[model samples]
Target: MKFLKVGRVAIITRGRYAGKKCELGEGLKTNSETEVLTEELQVVIIQPQDNGNKSHPYPHALVAGIERYPSQITRRMSKAKQTKRSKVKPFIKVINYNHLMPTRYTLELEGLKSVITAETFKEVSQREEAKKTIKKTLEERYTSGKNRWFFTPLRF
Candidate 1:
């Protein structure tokens, strides 16, 4: 009923938006200066949609949160591949948050490996008590880590 595992970030190579997938190689709290060319993105598991419905179609992945990446980072990553860089840059570091929802972005996962299985995602949202425990645990985890940031719940 509790979630101990942390989320990971990756780039969206192919989707409806194709090359415009949010850049997640960097963690969720990357700064504009460190954002060579990417957006502030997070990955989380969500319910899968049924095939029969059309209107108000259910989302296969629920968007928890979303924010734009630093402009510099977005520009660099979106640049056309003309020359190979000397070295492949490592994933950027962003502040980690606990008990906080991840940013929601529209990403088609038709062919990509999701961070967590659908079953896992549903189970987490099903129980209120479990959700609270998981959030607290995650908050502890985030605080111990460096440059981690937790979100205060929104009033809306």
Candidate 2:
């Protein structure tokens, strides 16, 4: 189980907002009461402080509708797993196929490409895409004799 540190909670009481997908901004404040269209409203459970108790009453109706889930308990169980991980030896090894062993020379080769293509190469922030490029480049270099593949260890 994974515990998410809740930053804020939202409880929407009426209209289309009366659904689980209501927008919740992070903070605690009494939002001004808008004129209710009707006394009957569909309450959407928006946000929870560790999953709010439905029995608890608040100005926000959304909080009152949130059914308690077993997630909080499940999250506690996973704590042991997380701690045990740091202590136990990792059976699965992370092999960087891009490098024989990511030593100084391999790292230097990667850095040199970044420096050379300082104009055309954009510094991409997405990690998955970056990794994909690196993996593709490695595969290409492993299969083909190409200088471009050599310089950019991360380029697909």
Candidate 3:
């Protein structure tokens, strides 16, 4: 099996986030400002849970991706509304390595490093707030025509 590095884009093939595309891991930023580095996080292999879940024996890597696809721009809506509707809804989840179908696309979202911290997933309110920031970042990237295919909803 291939190792999943940070910034690797993948599709979630199982559970609630099934079919949604996600990028693997947040960036690596050391506390020392003088020695700034944004490298891929380490991939650690952990022991399988005792739950006897055959489908996903040993899970590795945590990824964050859009939970809901952006809404279509309707002519009936105002410009402000249209702008709001364009944002991507995001979600952070610890998924099974097998459940993710890796793609050739890899999106290195610079804002995600600051927005998605370990504490972002600690509470509902914090998570929701972080999602809003992530939504804005994704929207900017999408509108800029960078990684257009990666941003679009996957078709059957």
Model 1, position 18, has a per-residue lDDT of 19
Q: Which run of 10 residues does model 1 get worst, by summed lDDT?
A: 25-34
lDDT of 3 at 11: 72
Residues 114-141, model 1: lDDT tens digits: 3322222344363333334333433343
Candidate 2 positional error at 53, Å: 43
TM of each candidate vs. truth: 0.25, 0.18, 0.68
- Candidate 1's displacement at residue 124, Å, is 12
Q: Which stretches of candidate 1 lie over 4 Å from their true place?
A: 1-56, 63-126, 150-156
lDDT of 2 by residue, 1-156 (tens): 011112112223343223211111111112223333322211112222222233322322111111211111234557766434222110001111111111111111132122112122233443234334434433344334332212221211
Pairs that collide in candidate 2 are 133-154, 134-154
Name the lDDT value of residue 106 in candidate 1. Answer: 32
Please rank every candidate by lDDT, starting with the best.
Answer: 3, 1, 2
lDDT of 3 by residue, 83-150 (tens): 78777766665666666677776677775656665556567898788778767777888778787676
| Clashes (candidate 3) | 0
